[model samples]
Target: MTNMALSGHTFPSATLTCPNCQTTITYYDVSGSSYYGCPNCHAFFKYENEGPPEILTTFQPSTATPVLPIGSEGYLNGQFVRVVGLLHKKEAGSFYRWLEYMLLRQDGRYSQLAEYNGHWMVIEPTDHTYSHYHVGGKTYTINTDEGQYWLYNQYKPELLNAVGEFDWNCLEDEKLTISEYIRPPSMLISEQGATDSKWYKARYISRSELATAFGIAKDVLPAPSGVGAIEPADPDDRSGTLLAFTGMLLVAVFVLQVILSIVKPSTQLLKESYQTESDSSGTIKPIITSSFDVDGPTVLAFNLSASLDNQWIELPVTLINEQSGRVYEFSKTLEYYYGVEGGESWSEGSRDDDAVLSRIPSGRYHVNIYPARDLGKPVSFSIGITQNTMLGSNIALLLLLFSIYPISLFVNKQWHESQRWSNSDYSKVYTEEDKS
Candidate 1:
């Protein structure tokens, strides 16, 4: 009787007698497969020129089994591919290990499914040309005809074990160098051997996707660990959209400010200069301004300015309503200081300042100013009052509020990028120099 395994898709099989253990081996010589490691006897065989296969090597039988068994068929990438071979390899001088499944399509093209740390990737050969770039100081970039890529990893793989069939002799002890360059969710891999070089492109695949493709339970699959090398940091990043929104809001706020300024221009109510006066008994009398009428429901700006070399003046003032005898008391301080420090001009304190009283009702009012100076010298200052003034501070506050979210998004994006690159040798954050 012929032994066959079928799961929707089927493959033709042949039987070969293992010369070492004299046990019959069932192999799927699918798509020009020429090498096989006997499952029962653990002996490697190679077939050439339609002749009887010759034994290459033999090993103690292993108790381990592959996750995706040999001869299993899976629908992947819009095509049905058979898992014809499996190879277990580990990075030389490191504990990193991975499993590679050689997949054969009906048209005889080969692809690979690789798994590391529970992360999976579908790898396929590419024919496009590429250029290597190393701009020094931890910058390793690869420019392909397709796009740009950043160096992710470089390693040498030592084969640990193998089973099933392959296009080349899997038992050969050949040295190969592999390099991976990534562009997030996709990677470009270069394999260099003693004789030739080949390039392949690999895309990240999720465990759920693989389960659906192979008709397996997702819970039975390996759970993922840390972030994969080429996995997307933020698949739904919206930093650009947020920046555009912030820019639009800024323009809108500026236009609104201009419109408001033109509609209710500030009207100067009173402008006067005052000097402190003293009575015969040396009692200083407060200076008073002429009464002014204010329109209801508007902002009143009290502006004060003084000229001083390095002195300060304080004015305790009150807005008194002549009709109601009600007083609104406030105070202002003006200080100016400047000097040359270390051959550079430095200045602190302003010669001019203003305070605003908002929502003042319509009424006749007068200002009372009680002046005090740092020195006993007589202090002279100018005071101006304006109505319905539109403050630039309001617009500045709105701009800051609108910019906060976009700035936060930018910072978060940069942080995620740094985390993604943390595993790479060319990490922008923790570089090799930093590691050393």
Candidate 2:
């Protein structure tokens, strides 16, 4: 689309010549502002300024503090009223709040609604009793446009005589007319009683009332494919948000470094109590007289059924702390884990891999042995509790020396994942999403 101007397009307005009138009428950018026109034409009409019309009310507005009960008085809008909810933008682009209300009759049952981006509409009914109007005896026309989805109207809260922050306590008490929903703090009426222009204006109030709104729970069914949370219908605050994130990340980096620097207690300071053994009859027991200690690079739990004779099985060995006089019972056997080379199993090192949490407080706690698996079967495996394996004291000491590292790594990893999620689909996200 290209067209050359007929004049030296100067004067504030980028003027265009009207074809019908041939008069040089100043054109306006899509945004209505400055205009162009040959001021001499007797038919010197003004610019086609089609913007949000100024709202005017001449009725004496009301000011009822406590919101009128829905069943109290004027609540229904001729059976076709709309309940407008607000998400008043406290600050341009900060965060939005939610408002909800109930519409009677034609608007459906306790239908739920929300701020269609900070703006909503309410129908000013003509009668309070039979709040219904029909056209041609069959079709009905609604008096309010606030119930539908994706609609907005902006108005000056002051024009409606609202102070601080006000809400339309009741529909019967207020009647407002919004010409166009656009930029401008236009009229936000809080109609209490009879009203008119100049002499009266609508009042506003913030009532604490819950609308019997109905909505379904979020769907959690497995997705057929990648899906996303609908983008928030409103703007988001990224500046301050991003800064908070950056601060969290720096803290994490520092901590992760410290953790990697802490010296994990030498794997050399540990002793085992006993070893595990199984007979040819597939029976097992701890090979301990009372309690023994051995280096912990431990492994190998096996059983054979060959030269078997008399049948007898001892209950599995359970762990207990004689110091506290508490016998820590095990079901069959307790499993342990550690990061190891590919060939290395969960019990990786040769019975010496120990980093257990046994000591935390100032007490002489001892270890016991019992089965933690195969409920009825006798435990026939030699398990080792090195002097330092999972020592609570050692772990606490380790955590204190450098809580920043692993914690930072964990938190940073988590934060990034959250950011990724906020910007991505829930189903497709994972721990790696926050790698940045």
Candidate 3:
């Protein structure tokens, strides 16, 4: 009896018996090349255009079962296909190994799926040469001859195991020469040799998509490790996005500050000069200033200048909102000290002091200044008040708060970049130190 699988298209089938084990196997000549392996005894065979099957050698059956078993069917690239063969290959001098599943459509077309470290890639043969290829609107140049020189032990790929039917004469000892060029999440591979030359386009696929396509549970798949040649950058990487958000927030803060400064203009409300006599008591009479109208929440800035040589002056002033009887008090200390240290004269404090009172409500306000002198001498000082002054401390504090996001984003980006270049030859963190 001839067993067959049907897809969207149909093909003529053939049956042969393995000479070594006498096991009956049924398959299709999708590529016209007669090469097959026994599913029961794992014996390799080859057939001519019209001849009996010749047994080459028996190979060891792989202990591991494929996620997509033989005879399993699926629809891919608008065509129905069935898994026909599986080849386990490994690079020489390295532990890197991959599985290639040979897929055949009922219409006699072939496709390949390569998997490495849990990463999947769908590869299809293309007539175009590897010299130039276009993907995602970008043209890439690949040189198979020159690339193989730098790649170590790349051509010697050991065929670990295989099953099912195949188109070419599959051999375990044959070394495959391969050249590859990667453009993150996608790659172009060129297989060239003395007998045949072929180019293939490889695209990365998620494990979830592969599991769903193969009708398998996601948990059965292995977790991916390291960076894949065609693995895409993480979409959830928020470094750039967070940096952009921080920039916008900073701009908004600057614009808000500018608008606030424009809307609430700082104007000189009062300027007066007063003198304190030493003959009077330590507490001088309060100097009453002219009242001014505040239209909104405002900042009152008081600046005092006094001529003092190695002396300090403490002036306490109180602002009274006459309409609501709200009193806002502030103090300013002006000191100018000069002395000779190590035969050099230096001055420490300035003779001017500034004090600011913020969030003063809308009302008529008056300033009452009480002056006191440390020495028994009279001192003259000038007083000035400005409304709606900008607070430097507040702006500085807000700027610091807004900078955290950008700093964090920069750090994360640097970390990711380091991870990307960890496998490179010219890495930032070198193994040896440079003495020169």
- Tens-digit per-residue lDDT, 241-327, candidate 1: 777788888888778768867887779999999877677987677888999998866888898988766888888889988998988
**Best lDDT goes to which candidate?**
1
Question: Predictions ranked by lDDT, top down?
Answer: 1, 3, 2
Clashes of 3: 1
TM-score of each: 0.73, 0.25, 0.66
lDDT over C-alpha atoms for residue 36 of model 3 = 76
* Per-residue error (Å), model 2, residue 51: 25
lDDT of 3 by residue, 38-152 (tens): 7788888887665777888788876656788766776676767778788887777767788888888756778888887777888888777745432212223444543411111
Candidate 3 segments exceeding 4 Å error: 1-5, 8-33, 48-50, 75-80, 105-108, 130-155, 172-174, 194-197, 236-291, 297-322, 325-360, 366-414, 424-436
| Alpha-carbon runs more than 4 Å astray in model 2 | 1-318, 322-324, 332-366, 371-436
| Candidates sorted on TM-score, descending | 1, 3, 2
lDDT of residue 263 for candidate 2: 33
List per-prediction Cα lDDT, in the order shown.
Answer: 0.78, 0.29, 0.71
* Residue range with the least summed lDDT across 10 consecutive positions in model 2: 199-208
